[model samples]
Structure formats: structure tokens, C-alpha cells
Target chain A: MDPTEREVACFEAGIKFGTLYHQFAGTPVSPESAASLERAMEAAVENQPHCTAVDVAILVDELDTTHDYTELTGRYMEVHMRIDYGETVVRTEMRMEDGYPMMRVVDVHEE
Target chain B: MDPTEREVACFEAGIKFGTLYHQFAGTPVSPESAASLERAMEAAVENQPHCTAVDVAILVDELDTTHDYTELTGRYMEVHMRIDYGETVVRTEMRMEDGYPMMRVVDVHEE
Candidate 1:
């Protein structure tokens, strides 16, 4: 069966977010890290027809005060992302698992 | 922030699917069981604005020839559902967790 527009948007967003997470796998949340993620996301979805615009936000876990990048391992991230595909928007909460991003669909809707 | 259209659709679909699963908590898959789930789903989203129509399909695990509904406790189900909300469609895979449905958003998209 054909996937719905919402499904396509969510799937594409998942791929972009996965790439973004990989870019910061072993690094802590810093300004430069955020910029690199944004650039990676832009590049990943640039040629996609449905995804017109994309925005991603990475918020470090407040409990991670030590900036102990090495200690914050496993699938335990507090990062959230928002992707805009003009007609549809997708929001996701993701966690890192073995250096890969595993996302949960927080929301998806039309503009 | 206001949730996007896709998010709202996925959230509502989650609720409906959750209710549908609860209605068949300890029952094995049978024609009667399927009918009961369908009826429950229809009632759950009957008045929702965006969800003009909804359809669900439950495929029992092929290995579940024993029909051991009780043995299939825990979060180990092979049930999948498809929910259509005119402009959007949501597909979910669910497992029973302590007799309640725990769904994973397999896909969601616009029509």
C-alpha cells in the first residue's frame, strides 16, 4: 500500500535526524556541534521533493552537568527535533543507541 | 507550541489503537475477536473531526497456532493497525504490555 504523506515526511525526517545524530555521536552538545548537525541535515534532505525546509534543535540533558561526553553513553538522549516539509511538519524525540539515533514520533501534522 | 497536523493525527490514532487493543486483552484472535476490536475502534474515534474513516487489521503470529492467548502475555504481540484520517494515514505496530497496547509508529503520512 502507498504510504500517506505524513508517513513519508516522518520517514524522511527520521533519516535526516539519524544522520544528524551520527555527526555528534561521541561529542557533547556544543555550539559547533549544533551547527555541524544542522548542516548535515540540510545536506541530507536538500534533494528531497517533499521536504522543503528543515529545522533541528538539540538540547543537552540538564543532568549532564559535567559535560562528560564519554559518560553519556547508551540510548539515553534528551534531544528533540522539528522538521518542516511545507505542507507537513514532523517532531521527534530521539535517543542514541550504540551510536545510532532511535526516534519516537512525537507529532506530525499539516501546516 | 501547537502540534502539527501529522502529530495530532498520530496522537489520536494512538489513542484509538490503544483502546482497540484493550478491548481484546486476554482474547485469542478469532472472527468474533476481530469484530469486537473493530467495533471498539469505531466507537473510540466516532466523533473525531479529522478521522473521517478508520480501518484496522490484526494478523496473528503464524507461530501462534497454539492459540495460546495467555502465553502471549508481556510486550510480545505481532499486531498491526492502519488508521486513516482522510488527509492523513497512520500505520502502527503494537505489542501488549501488561495487558495494554504499546504502539510503535511504523508509518504516518498524508493521503
Candidate 2:
């Protein structure tokens, strides 16, 4: 069976989450570069269809600065995304949970 | 409402695809770096839950070759991913479609 609009809305949110995480995960970062990278990541995913907004916060203090820069990963960031698919809307976010980076849906609705 | 197992499986597959595409999209690549990037990308996504395998092919011939490197993007690569979620398995691939790098599911089935 084809997916319902709600399912698709969930799928779209998932895609944004995946895209946001994967695309920026390995970028080099330091306290100096974190802000720009966050803005760039937000702008990148917002370019996708159905995405209304993307918020990224890179934890510079937690970043490993041994080499003056480190690879970005879930541990160093958190994200929020809002996606609207037709009348169905989804809000999702990713943050550290139980020592793991977890992406979870906050709400799903139709308007 | 809750997403079904199948829906969750589909969502997982989407995450892997997103991770694969985004995490490596902006990487600096040349023929010399393509092979190593491919291997590293595969290993990275495979660390995610439910992801079984990842295959990445950086189109060395298609690379810009200017400055001996270029930022990676969907146009410069092709990818295939397999994910297993309990009894549900999903197969997907990404390629250039109609001038856009499109990621699509090839099959979703239950065992």
C-alpha cells in the first residue's frame, strides 16, 4: 500500500534529519568555525522541499580542539526541524540522549 | 498516532540515505581521495543501527579537477545502501535523475 500523507510527512522529516546529520557530521570545526557551520547547515537543509526551518547548535566547548579543529558529529551538536507536507506538519529534533545522539519526533499534526 | 514497523523501517532507510549523501557531500575530493572517502563513508553509516551495508562510488572522472580538488556533492557520486530492521529489509540507491541527484528505494520487503 502507498504511504499516507502522515507517513510521508514523517518520512520527509526523517530525510531532513538524516541529511542534516550526515551532511555536516564530518566537517572540521573549532569554536571559531562552529557558528558559521551551524548557519550553513541550517541553510542547506532548509533548501529542501517541505522544510520550513532548520536549527543547528554546535557545542564548541565539547568539541575536541586538540588539533585546533575536529570532525563534527552528533556529540557536538543538536538540531530541530519543522516540515510541512501539504496539510500534514511534523516537528522533529535531535539531541544527545543516554550517551547516544537521538532524533525524535516532537509532534505530528494536520492543518 | 505511531508509525508502524514498516514505516519505521522506511524511516530508517531514509536516515541512512540522508546521512550518506549529506555527510560526504561537501568533502574535498580528487581521484586520490575518492577511494578513501568511499571506504570511510561506508564505514561511517554502517555504524548506525539497522544499516547493513553502504557502497559509495565517487565519480573521479566527473570531478572538477580544478585546484586538484573539489567539494563533493550529489552530482559527483553514486550510492547504494541496504538496511535491515528486524524482519523488514530495505534497499535503496542514489543516482543522478533528470539533472538532480535523487535517492530512491529499490525494494522493501518482509521476511
Candidate 3:
């Protein structure tokens, strides 16, 4: 099936976030990195058949880079995702772990 | 100095294209893929100080995937890029070569 508008928008947002993250982190967002992020989003809602949108944003003000710069220091990010199948909304915080973006759910509201 | 609006837009476009390319190619746009594209863009106008924007578009109608799908078959793409420095505009055709996006100048006009 052709992807929905929301799906396309969500995917586009993912791309934007990937670029923004690399820009602030002083790293370049490579295609590999983007694929990793796409996999993460898929994993996030793997079981949800109706999941349509996934949005990720950086809390720029909350970003902290005080750790050793020589090593990869995972930073916090804000995520708001939507699952249309169940009218579900997921709000969470996430960070990179071992070079992978991981999320911790803060809220899941079902409408 | 802060990045120019055009720079940010170009970078964002790069991200979008990376995703779009993978979506169509059935492969994945990785961090490495994005980085390589960025490098190619840099190389395109490295000497130009006022270069600002780069845009990429897929020639969906021209896309011919009749070849072996298992292998990376580089496809042609349409590109319109701008360099504000010399008031330049770059219109070209590009494709993936050896797993990297490569461009060939079709037209370069300064206004």
C-alpha cells in the first residue's frame, strides 16, 4: 500500500531530526546513521499495525555535553509518536546507546 | 558564525534525498550514505565561498528498475543547486556510483 501522508511526514521528520542531531553533535549524519534511526522507529511500534507517525525532536536547552568529548556520550531527546490504529499517542525521552538510539516511554495515551 | 538559512535548507534537503533514495532503491540510506553525499556536495563547490543551496529530485518517470534488483543499479536523478556566492545556479543530473551519489553538470548559469 502507498504510505499515508502522516507516514511520509513522520519519515521526513525523522530525516530532519537525524540531520539536526548530527549538526549539534558536530558529527555528520550518514545514510547508515539514518537507516539505524529508521530501524529504531520500526522497533518502537513493531507490534502496532496502525502506527502512522513518529516525531522526534531535541530539547536543545536541555542538552548537556559535559562529558568527555573524545567518547560517544549519549544525549537526551524528546519524542512524540502516534499510532493511528488504536488512536494512540506516545510521548517519551530517548538517547543513543552503544551507537543506537534507544527510547524510554514517559506516557502512552489511548484515545 | 551561524550557518546560513540556505545551508541549513541544503543540509535538510540532503537528508530528505537520502531517505527518498533509499525508499525507492529498496536499500537503506545509512549515515555513511548521507556523509558521502555531503562530501560530494562539498567537492562540487569547495572553491566557491558563497555557495549556499543544493537541491535533489528523483526523476520518477525516468526510473528504470528493469535491471537486476539484487544489485545496486545506479539510477538517474534530477538536481537543481544554487550557489549564492557567484549568484550561480547549477542544474544537473546525478546517480549513484560505487554506492556513492555522483553528479554530472548538465548546465551552469550565473545570474
Candidate 4:
């Protein structure tokens, strides 16, 4: 069976989430660099097709400040993305779930 | 609509590839850090469910020598990943396509 355009849209949404999570996870980040990193992440993913917007928040309060900076990880940030494909639109979010970062589809509907 | 096992496998493969690519893409890299980075990437993705093996190679020779270190990106590395979901197995690869990193499933089959 062939995948519907809806399924393709879902797959694309998953791709964006995976990309956002992986691409910046281990970067050296500190409270000072968090804002810049967040902006960079959003701009980087928005370059992808059908990605209408991206929002990234680095939890500065939770960052391990044992040193001047720490490696960025899911435990320290949250993300949201909006992807539109054909007439279908998908909204996804990522945050701590069971102490691990989980990305999931929040909503999907036809425009 | 529902996705088949193969599709789920493909989606899983995509996540690993995306994670592998994005998680490490912007790290400051010199020839010295490439090996450790590769190992960390493999270990990280391997922790994900259904991922069996991951191979990452950073092209040291391509480092932009104008500076002691450069940001990692698709132009600097190649990745291969193997994922198993139920009886379905998927192999994925990432390399430059049209001058951009492209993650694609190389094979999917049921054992």
C-alpha cells in the first residue's frame, strides 16, 4: 500500500524533530550562549521545506554549571515545530517525558 | 491511516540519521576530536530502540585549516546506520545530495 500525503507529512514532521534534537544536542552551551544557540537552531530548521516555524528553549536553570558551560542535551531544553505539507499540517513538540526527551505529534489536520 | 511496519522502520531509521547528523553537525572539530566524536555519535544513536549499528566517519582531510577548528557539517562526515524493528531491518545513509546533507533509507526488509 502507498502512504497517504498525510503519512508523508507525519514522516516529515518526525524528521524535523529528529533533526532539531540531534543537530545541537552536544554543543557547548552556557547561560550566555543559550539564546544564540536557540536562535541558530530555529533558523537552521526553518531552512527546511514546509517548516513554517521553529521554537527552541534552553533551560538555563537546569544546565549543569559545574563549568562555564555544559554539553547541551534533551534534559536541558524543549522544542516545538510546525510543518505544513500539501493540505496537511502537523504540529510537534519535544520535552522531558519519563526523564528522557520525547518528540510527539500534538496535532495533525487538513487545511 | 496507519503506517506499516516497514514504514515505521523507515521512520525510525530517519530519526537515527537525523539525530546523528544534527546532534554532531555544529560541534567544534579538529582532526583530534573527530574520532572521539564519531564514537560518541555511534554510542548515542545506538542507545535508541531498534538501532543496531552506526558507523560515522569524519573526513579529517577536509578540515578548513584557516582555523584550528571548524564546525562539523554534512560536508565533513558520512554516516551509516542499521535499525531493526520487529522483523523489519532498515539501513540508512547520509551524505551530500545537492550540496546538502540527505538522510535516506538504503534498504528495508523483513527477516
What digit string (tens of lDDT, one per residue) describes model 2 on residues B1-111? 455566567677878888777767788899998999999999999999999999999999999987999999999999999879889877778899888997766777788
Candidate scoring better on lDDT of 2 and 3: 2
Model 3, total clashes: 13
**Docking band of candidate 1:** incorrect
Per-candidate TM-score, chain A: 0.52, 0.96, 0.33, 0.97
Off by over 4 Å in 1: A28-77, A95-102, B1-111
- The 10-residue segment of model 2 chain A with minimum total lDDT is A1-10
Q: What is candidate 3's TM-score for chain B alone?
A: 0.34
Tell me the tens digit of each residue's lDDT in model 1 across A7-98. 55564555444344443345544433555654664565444434455554444343255543332222434455566655777776656556
Q: What DockQ does candidate 2 score?
A: 0.37
| Tens-digit lDDT string for candidate 3 (B1-91) | 9866544534443453443344334222232233333333333232223335455443334444353112112454444554443344544
Q: How well is each residue in A32-102 modelled by candidate 2, as lDDT tens digits?
A: 98999999999999999899989999988999989999999899998989889899877888999888999
Residue A77, candidate 2: how far off, in angstroms? 4.4
For model 4, how does the per-residue alpha-carbon lDDT over B1-111 read when each residue is reduced to its tens digit? 345566566556666776777666779999998899989989998999888999998889998868899999899888888888898877777788898877666666789
Model 4: docking quality category: acceptable
List, residue by residue over A1-111, the lDDT tens digit for candidate 4.
344565556656767878887777789999999999999999999998788999999999999999889999999999998889899877878899899897766777789
Go through the candidates in order and give each one's C-alpha lDDT: 0.51, 0.84, 0.41, 0.81
The model with the greatest lDDT is 2
